[model samples]
Target: MTSAFIHLKASRLGRMAAACLAALALAVPAHAEKLPRLVLAGPAAAVSVPLIHMVETGALKEVADSVEFVTWKDPDQLRVLALGGKADFLAMPSNVAANLYNRGQPLKLLNISTWGVLWMVSRDKNLKTLADFRGKEIAMPFRADMPDIVFGLLAERLGMDPKKDFALRYVASPLDAMQLLITRRVDHALLAEPAVSMALRKTKSFPISVVAPDLYRSVDLQQEWGRLFKREARLPQAGITVLGKAMSNDALQAKVMAAYEKSLAWCQKNARQCGEMVAKRIDLLSPEAVADSLAASPLRHVSAAAAREELTFFFQQMLAKNPALVGGKLPDAGFYGNAGRP
Candidate 1:
């Protein structure tokens, strides 16, 4: 062939190849623009269970090359993970999420999955109400945080003082409170699951007798919340938040959230399987205890914006007692990720 003819054919082939490449690019989903790695962090509570499921199931494979789950034992560790930008997604208390957001953290709460996990476990079975435990030394965890704030709000509403009405024994973590219960060191304790379940299970085992110091799922804080606040028998407690760079990626955010919601439903349905999986990650928990906790806890997934009204009420209540609870004031509309959605 002549030189011009050969050059013309080469140019035509190049154009066709470029068109094919463009077509392939358009065919890929938006979430296909994957990140190198993604880190998810949370406490070993029910809120983090779904995240563990997502990682195990490779639910976010399309959004990231690798997905990891890290456990933060306390509020300080959680804050460390978030403040250091170590995690892209985190499971945290709703109020903490609000506090961080109000304090100008570049994070947005995606959904509230843990509604009511706080319960008052006591040795006295006859203890029917929060008022019934007057003057008792009750082991409490996360002193100024969750279960504490909820307890305070309820006590103050009932015209009782949290600090003066009851003897509150502050501890470092829920497990410490559970230990106090298991050892028969305290007659009462406010604990979140699966620590509650673990406590009940441990107390009934070998060395410990079933009758002497058997624990009861005494007054449920959620129940009191409903009766006193005239609201549902649940609280907008804990949920997942997307942070830093991930907040701007809408497609990835949607994928992460959809996976989380689906995983949460899966966990509730397959409690045994979920429990086993979660227990493997958190050595402090047992499969049976996790399963029991799931059954007892009012676990549900409500989008952050959908839960705003209830959250606003909760935040307002907290702000009343302690202005610093929610970082001085209510977080603006932007705090809720993907706001205005149904």
Candidate 2:
């Protein structure tokens, strides 16, 4: 072939190769770098639902070579995970995130995904409000943490002392409180989502029905919070926090938040399927209950920066009740992650 013909051929081949590479890049996720692996941790709650979905669906495959979800059942376990730098991301209570951040843990709040999932389940259907059940025994979980802090503030707002107005039986976790309710050991219990739905579901199912008393999801604390606190009928209770190594990876953090938000939306829209998937991952929860929890929960994804106002309001409320609840003060702006567009 002549020199011009050869040059023309080479140019055509180069264009075709570039087009092929473009198609390949489009077909696969374009990541400049990927972490060898990532661990997403959370409790067996609604906030963690999307994390499990992300792992099962490989939602963060582009950002990391592998992503897995680990369950941290209680605050101690959550602390251990954070302190030990074992988890890259975590689904944690908003207050706990603030506490950790204030205490100098290298972590940042990514987004608040769990808006309102806490509820007061009771055997007494007549109990309509927080005050109505005064002077009665109620099982509470994670005393001085999240739902407890929220309960205390709400009770104080109503001019009723939490410890004096009601018999607050502190339990280790929501599931423990749930068990007490199901077994009729406690007439009322404060439970978060999935647990709340589980209690409602288990009470009616077969052998448990023989002994378990009929329960009612009576007092919605979020509603009570709004009514008494004069705000929206939702609280910034929980969100995902980027921990340890994940905090430094801004691109990965953004991608992770994007995947989490998309996963959360997917879980809400496809509750039944999401429930089954979550059920497989968390043995304590049932598919039916998970689906019900989704319907009942006011789950939303709000970026940390965008949610700062509401979160500050929440932290301020907690701070007023007990300074230790948020590690003695509101976290600096650095506590919030600049990830994912709200």
lDDT per model vs. reference = 0.89, 0.90
Per-residue lDDT of candidate 1, residues 58-87 (tens digit): 998888889999999889999999899999
Residue 36 deviation, candidate 1, in Å? Answer: 1.9
Give TM per candidate: 0.94, 0.90
Error of 1 at 158 (Å): 1.0
* Residue-by-residue lDDT tens digits, candidate 2, 172-216: 999999999998898999999999999999999988988986899
What is the C-alpha local distance difference test score of candidate 1? 0.89
Candidate 2's C-alpha lDDT? 0.90
Q: Once model 2 is optimally superposed onto the true structure by TM-score, how far is the C-alpha of residue 60 displaced, in angstroms? A: 1.5
Q: Model 2: residues >4 Å from true position, as ranges?
A: 1-32
